[model samples]
Target: MNQAIANLASEADRAEALQLQLEAGETIVELDPKVIHGSFVKDRLDGFTDPKFIELREGLKTSEQIIPVLVRPHPDIKGEYQLAFGHRRVEALRQLGRKVKAIVRNLSDEDLILAQGKENTDRADLSFIEKALFALRLDQQGVRRQVIMDALTITSKGVLSGMISLASSLPTELIEAIGSAPSIGRPRWETFAQLLADPSHESTWRELIRQEQFHALSSDARFERTLKSVAVRKEKVSDEQIIKTGEGRKIATAQSSKRAVKLTIPTKHTGEFAQFLLRKLPDIYEEFAASAANTTSDNE
Candidate 1:
């Protein structure tokens, strides 16, 4: 038995070394969890059933598939691996009282950030509201707003901005429901934010949310109906700026036509980077002026 344990440890070590290499840059097959963290046990032993556990339990039992997880070593986290993704898999392992399985990859600091961003962007299971909330957090992290738009494959900045605004405006409970709702999307959330801001129509909006019938309404129709409800009661205006229509509102704002330019230099020019930053500012203004002139000519 002791010899078996020793051999297992050796195999794990070898696997971990290979996985680390993959995380560094090399692309390889998915790795097992024992190789990454030395054990599959979850530190959190909560019995809650969530999407993560469901996927893991089903995948391990019914499907023959290798689940991918991002394992980053935590400075303060001890005993278990920090999950960059696969929150569900980690939890499911805990619930089943079994060893967790994962792909062990060593990621650099920058790579981890990019991984986190892309993981959130690529999730097909995320609801409209969840996507909005995720995007909002990414925006707050000082991740370039356009990065969120591009990486998420959002067609327009307006859709991205609307989601951010919707997440910010809704109540926490409602936000969670929104995240779970099947029919909600960027346009719906943006429209709902406008509706919820109106004091006179708060009850109706609350009812719409409470009953879950909002899912049945088309996004444009819902926004229009909500706005119409508020329009009739304009005399009962509260301190909040009530939107009677989506027009001229901040929700569906247009994207700026500016493209970003990145510059790299040799390590020796470290001191001259400040001058490089200064040199790029005028180019932005020049681009904006040129764009405006083109627009004016097209209109004329």
Candidate 2:
């Protein structure tokens, strides 16, 4: 961060430093164990103090099994390091009481941007909801949507919107719970968030989740049916009646009538067209009610 120290750094290092600052902003750069800065050594520190930083460090420690530390030299800032990528890994290393082994590459300005972009993108630990929030923040920070799309390898704004929308539906506790789980992938997380959005249906959804029924409805057909069933139940309607009416609504006459009288028939019905029609008929139309025409037709 010092001007004189920055002046001493190589042009490549300076450029890299500038780029990193531009992309991710300034922070305390951990010194390379091999190349000491001032009095700092590789295993000099105990652990990070900031709770958020500590959490990030713990996540990194857990993620070390996947990827190791990646670093790029900051040409402008001497005694300062540019994290090319592996932020989580670096945090993990710092947490684990180990020195970060860096590549020490002399990166150009463009390279630094690419590295930050790639690193932020490739090693993101956000859940579906978190990604949406992160992307939304980036969008507000003057980062182009296309740039975010490119960085995240996502094609449509719908995907981002869906994540945000779904997350917006959940309670903070639910969001935190989902975010903490490393095993929950984007798709599952998104689904969970979406379901949680409708509070009336959450209990049923939770029951389904408890029973591990999602496994049985893995296919598209079953999944859609499950969603529809829950949706109907949430609406306080019989799922079977809803499904039946839905099918009928699609193909029924398709005509806009001048006047229509809708009546509720208190019965459960399904199957052939005749059977469905029979269920809707007046009580007098039943075989047992031959003598008295007790029920009046709505549109007679």
Candidate 3:
């Protein structure tokens, strides 16, 4: 994108540009959102949590759906359509209970892929993982690499093949389990994919991902949690050391391992200090107990 052109373009112009990359070059039209089904195969991110998506929804609430989405008449479903691009618009209108404005062309399966990929590419909208997943979907349909490259504007077939392979390595259940981790990029996903290749990590991966706390996390955090769990490189040895002072000191030692922890006050430094500790244990124990309960609750 030229800086000057981008700088001068209004929001409406951007929306039109974002949406109007129809592969069939069809005329735009107004249609009801309820009548349009999503792609036959899922090619886009699932959950609509992106801030831009939310903004689009809020914008639709206040204004008419000006930017027309690209849609094709559904082959199987009479009087229905399939979206090539503009899923965000479709989703927003669906949530708002509003009719969609679309360009209804009878696009071929391959054309639909092209149109969808092109529109997202023009907008730079798809995350690296999202693009990888979309590539995997296109490949599953037996779409040619040249077509995929042209659609996604990738010059390298090797990169495209790698993306599909990486995406295919992980189960669909696991992808949905993780949601769309938009904040995670290629390197992290590649690392996570490599970790998934090990059979021994499966149980640990399932355990980490299945936790309620995992679901409670942001998309990025969810990805991070999975990556950290089974990778031995991330395996940490927790510290255990005692601080000492000649007579008495405020210093204490907290010893921790992977599974257990202990806090100690050195008896060598202050003889008979155990009695003082005992006397203060009630207050200290209360605080510790409260903290432990909070940690447990957070984990749960």
Candidate 4:
């Protein structure tokens, strides 16, 4: 009878604490990890083999999840919940087949996204490209630009524009293939985007990413390899050739590469040569065009 009275007292104390929590706009609850679905917009590219995730899983094996995940009652499914944040914790708990401690709230779609993005920003764990892609996904989903900027903590319109542009320029498949390259920054990603501007180069990346060897590499290494694979190798410039008059007096020196020829004329002759080259360019281009047409005809 004394044990039963103690149990009743404990239950009453718990109820009072829960009421306080509700009044403070939060109610902590234990939920089956299986019933909590991930946020609609993904903000991470962490796989099972990811070192951080592995570490989290291993840590959870021994310690309790002190931080509670934020969740909302499932809008569509009765008796289930949708996660707002703490995806890693929920996933770890799910893998361990343990209950998830969560803070339940009533949140609208925008509210959920705001909470999700805020948590990630506070943690400062999402990579540059991951944040960009998340913004892009929110944009694609018709979320207001202001909301996206607020969610990402972006203050400048130009910054937001660049993020969306970078995300839009790359093929989604390629981004997924590369995963989140944490060490790679904006400049390298922009360079990679420029390299892939030629559609033919994308196929090279596609084929390379399909290979088992590429998949074996780490995310950052995969990005490096992919960038190297599609990068245009600059052709070696040929040795300089001397140009001379009929008397063999050197007038200029010319160096040629696959794309261009640079002629270095003495400064004294600059004006005269510039005028002369301008005068002769039309005839030279006509001859070149005729020769190109003949080569094409012969090949056909």
Best by lDDT: 4
Residue pairs in collision within model 1: 40-100, 52-88
Model 2 global lDDT (CA atoms, 0 to 1) = 0.48
Please provide, for model 3 over 4-57, each residue's C-alpha lDDT reduced to its tens digit, 9 standing for 90 to 100: 466356555755664555534656677787888888667665568757688889
Tens digits of per-residue lDDT, candidate 2, 1-300, equal 675455445435645755675477444444544432211111111123424457666665655333333455545556666555545456556557767655455665345434555554443433344555545545555566666666556789888666556545555433332233433456765565565465556666556544445534323333344456565564553222222264454222221223533333334332365466666677636654654444444335
- lDDT preference between candidates 1 and 2, better one: 1
Writing each residue's lDDT as its tens digit, candidate 1 over 1-300 gives 986687577647656765676787755344334433311212111123444456557666654434446676643545445555665655445444455545445665345545555555544455576667667766776767776676466879887887777777876554543334445566665666666675446676556656657645543345455556555444344233322235643221122213422333333534465466469879978999999999999999
Q: Candidate 1, TM-score vs. the true structure? A: 0.48
Off by over 4 Å in 1: 1-56, 62-65, 78-80, 106-110, 120-123, 155-158, 200-300
Query: Model 2, poorest ten-residue lDDT window?
Result: 37-46
Clashing pairs in 2: 12-75, 13-74, 13-75, 13-76, 14-75, 14-76
> Best by TM-score, which number?
4
In Å, residue 171's CA in model 4 sits off its true spot by: 0.8
- Between candidates 2 and 4, name the one with more favorable TM-score: 4
Number of clashing pairs, model 2?
Answer: 6
Clashes of each: 2, 6, 0, 0
Rank order (by TM-score, best first): 4, 3, 1, 2
The C-alpha RMSD of each candidate to the native structure, in angstroms, is 21.7, 15.7, 14.2, 14.7
